[model samples]
Target: MLRRTVLLTFAGAALGGSLWQGAAHASEGRSPYGPLQPPDDVGLALPEGFTGRLVARSGHRVAGLAWHAAPDGGACFPDGDGWIYVSNSEIPLLGGASAIRFAHDGTVRDAYRILSGTNLNCAGGATPWRTWLSCEEAYRGRVFECDPYGSRPARPRLAMGRFKHEAAACDPDREVVYMTEDEKDGCFYRFRPTDWGDLTEGTLEVLCHGMVWKEVPSPAALVKATRHQVDDARHFNGGEGCHYADGVCYFTTKGDNRVWAYDAKASTLEPIYDADSPLSGVDNITGTASGELFVAEDGGNMEINVITPQRVAAPFLRLHGHSRSEITGPAFSPDGTRLYFSSQRGRRGILTDGHTFEVTGPFTI
Candidate 1:
């Protein structure tokens, strides 16, 4: 078994649970999991006692509607005793978000579209209000707030910003939404809502030196790029994924292969993992109730690496085939016993062959 002791643990109640795991959680890093077994029937290599199951496949009928291709960022939402896993489709023009209703016992109850008619719907964050922020990863893209239950119609949150958006992380304590841009010279941003839980209007600011905030004169960037609108905005090398737990916000920079930790309370930003670290090609990210971070690789060894609370990072699982594919969404179930993610390009290394998988095992809390 691999384990470590964290030097710092957040206060308050963590109960140690999951984003559909209830997404980012605060808990001690104490995992009692062992090494990977062999590659399973699904071509996935997981740890001992952990089993993988196919939850959805691209271009296939899940419930009735054909599943979307190129599944990207996703989160689990609690639905009664069961839960719903919402995923983004990365296909241009047809890009949107979909949801899979799961029974308490992990059975697929239904599958349907939540958001549609968007472009390049990539990674996004889960809000405390049970809404999924589906981001569009294209030029002048926007963030769409979709209901996981598929009841309410999805709305475009134009005030958030209009750039090549990749992902978002909601900081409820501070009532801010942290976002990442997927450009070579992208800038990290945060939107402060005019009212708590409201996304229609807000002040969009970019993160500057010393973790300070600098107001972005424009969000739509019709005249100038949003990253250039702020004079002192800190530049990141292609930011991809963002997640928040306790008071710390963790995000990934794909170009630099770095995982950043932004201490909201302390007002500081630092890299927790870098190019020399164990993981590479870090893309989509998520955390467990035990406070362990799960980072999916975009091009490396096709592995999902785990970062312990003590900051020890290592690979937890790897896919055997599909070398051309990159791992996207890495989320957990509400009970924290099961994990969900997708291979953007599965067996044939194409968008239409994407696969969303579920892995169930005994995870430490």
Candidate 2:
């Protein structure tokens, strides 16, 4: 029998037993669960003003998505006016790498099977140079920079190292890139390009503190060591979703239910938000035009949480059946007027169907 779960309330009580206790407690102050309505089974819900329509469906194991602006704006460019690039982590059990592009109107414009026979087509980030870095989250992981516009072929940036990479973010202003490892005791990494606009060679370092896990040096030494050394010498937890702002970067950890901010100047890791807040189950996160932060929840009660500058997380949008849906990709339009995101079905289970959607809002805090 298919079970139905009421997100804001029951899911909060249940998640309170696990890693989301903080979020549960925080939600108590607000009406975390909204009114139940039609289409609840599908896991989608919206406020009175906003509406959501299915843009593309069943697009070959779609995961991460990046939205490019249309030269001449008419609509949000759902089909193919600009370009909608999707990552195929696993296609029909083939276990390879592939990407597809659609016209502003959702027509299949072009496709590329960049790397064949690979596993785990997880989330990736866009560069200031206008390229996509698709990360491979497997043993001996690697990061590939591919030209979605077809200017360059997809190839692994060897200087970025090989490990269980989750997501990659580039700071165009500094010619430096940041990467995260998806391991139980993974480390955060930074790549400094030898030349501007060229990522051929650079130094890699893990984050480390005086005697704590400040940051590791690049070309990390993941040697086996004691628990103290591992904690102090190494960074840990499930590293996922990275975004760059002014001079700091933010990343998520599914295992810890925590999000961290890395200050470029001070070179430190400070906690930005935690799952203990009202926005628990945060999976992937991105920034908005007004500088607010939005996060997607992977667990049941599928909803997007918005974090205000005051550091409070409120329910942004409730995807009716989102618990069964894995919300992965969240990117804003070039004008920042529209937000595009992708949802994957059966990632934690069986069944591999993916779809994309465009959301517009009055964006009130």
Candidate 3:
């Protein structure tokens, strides 16, 4: 497995002291939100002055729609007087996506299903055209383009390639979509649409070492053909979350427990953070308008790792008392004032259902 390979490959150097010591966080005085506070009564340990409020929990009904289970990936879009936050369900058989309309004051007014009849709908990326691309994380998985306002029915975007999918990020300037795979031997992909902002059809290419581009003959079988069968390309261990900011594509590798940044223009890749140094099990990632990266830890003593532009890593928020679960989502509002995320499996033994929350406070400007 790629996860096994990555562990055998980088386990020895995961704490390669000197190489990453320089990347450690600066003193608290340099922190943008200050030191993190203890877990609040709501089970979230956030930064000072920050508070988290539960928006929806599993089985809750909103706008005549019973909240979906296992809310995984999500994105927020501007709406009338507020915005809509769309979340993907990781349930394999009943995989789908949901949308919750949040008022400007941060309250969820109504929630409804936007996409249905999918499989393992995982993390996805929001597009410049104000649509959400909900990704399926199954073998031969697909990306579905969804409209949050319910103006258009969700459509499957076949050209985006298939694999054990994770999340995607769009380069608004280039109109290219960057995606990640959740397999240990997964490859990072880029989809160039024939028409800008359109994902119905495109060419898919995998990023190889030295930033070289290699076209996947049949992206639908990429996992079987190149990743497992022939298996010669350099692959990331369990690619999870991805976000594009300032022309840079940043994604996380869960098995390797690392975050990497790819500069498409320069075709260069660089590591930003390592596991256990401050965070581990890196999953869904999002970039703040300020360019800082927020990463949700998957299934551990769950905590959100904040990586500054300078590469410093700090504990942004921790999910206290949650067991057998991890944090998902982690998207910011259009204005970047409010942060939204979900506890995939909810608190251990106490709340078995999934739940979503919104965090508001003095976010860095």
Candidate 4:
């Protein structure tokens, strides 16, 4: 196994488990998990004090609908009695997003499809207004904003631009979104909405050298026209998972096995952690209620890497005995008590099936 790690010098002192050194957490003093326990029957290995449960499995009847195939990116949302986790399907042509509702006790009450008829619905991020921004990872791809509760129909947010979309992180305070692309030579983009919490229309731009912003007149065109036009200088090397934490947008590049932090306020992008050789294929990333970051691995042994407040990167959980699968969609409940994630390939290496599980334990902030 090849492993690579490089120390980065940020602007502030380390805060142990408080925040990401210089970056202040949007929320403070959140709880943290005590320890992780072995999986009961879920086929996962957790910390000594934590326990995991298989909530939904592909091909299983969840609620009235069959759990969607190839569960990819997902996010948790507040519900009446508990919460709902929306997952995207990465299958081409038939790809869509699905939702599973869990009670306050972590018992899943229902699961159903939210967005359908999309292509390669890969990883996505939750919006500030309780919506899921499902990104299609294909040429001429677009983003679909789907209501988590099924209160409204999922529609394509055309104004947000379209170009091999991967994932998005919304900064509600600034009413802007930071997005990642799946191409090896993709550009990092940001969408500034005309109205806060409204994603129907927006101005799309890409980050260039010197922290400069270049307008993308037609995102769909630039992606398919010259192909390398937008990737001339700022290619992110297979941009993958992304999430907005505190005031910074953190994302990963699978090709480089690096996680980067983009401070929208400073308009600067810098590496925070580089994986040791064995820790490659960084995928979907999310944060705990306490501001700690968790990143899923797309391949390499299928483990989830945790970044503590002190900026230490370490493996937190491993998909025991699973060799052909990768971990995706690492998300947390709104209250920060339970952690949710999915395995792209089934536990038994079944290509057509996947599983989603929840880990609950004593979490500290």
Descending-TM-score candidate ranking: 1, 4, 3, 2
lDDT by residue for model 2 (141-241), tens: 56677665554577777777767777878887667888877787777777777886777677665666552333233343355311123345556577877
Ranked by lDDT from best down, the candidates are 1, 3, 4, 2
The lDDT for every candidate, in the order shown, is 0.85, 0.56, 0.78, 0.78
lDDT of 4 by residue, 1-365 (tens): 64445434344422233434454322112123323355456677777678787777788888777887788999999998699999999888999999998888877788777899899999889987889999999888889999889878999998877678899999876788889888877888889988888888778888877788777767567535313555443777888988886667888998888888886666667777675633557888988656677888988878786776654566677787667888888888888888888887776776467888888766554
* Candidate 3 segments exceeding 4 Å error: 1-31, 222-232, 349-352
- Please list all clashing residue pairs in model 1, or write none if there are none: 18-21, 18-22, 19-22, 19-23, 20-76
In terms of TM-score, how similar is model 2 to the real structure? 0.74
All predictions: root-mean-square deviation over Cα? Answer: 5.3, 8.8, 5.5, 4.1
Tens-digit per-residue lDDT, 1-365, candidate 1: 23322222232222124221112322333234666679999999988889999889998899887889999999998899999899999999989999999999999999999999999999999999999999999999999999999899999999898999999999998999999999999999999999978899999999987678988888988999899997878999999999998877889899978788777876766666654445668899998877788899997889898877554566788898879999988888888888999999998999999999999988765
- lDDT for 208 (candidate 2): 63
* Cα error, candidate 4, residue 326 (Å): 0.9
Which candidate would rank higher by TM-score, 1 or 4?
Answer: 1
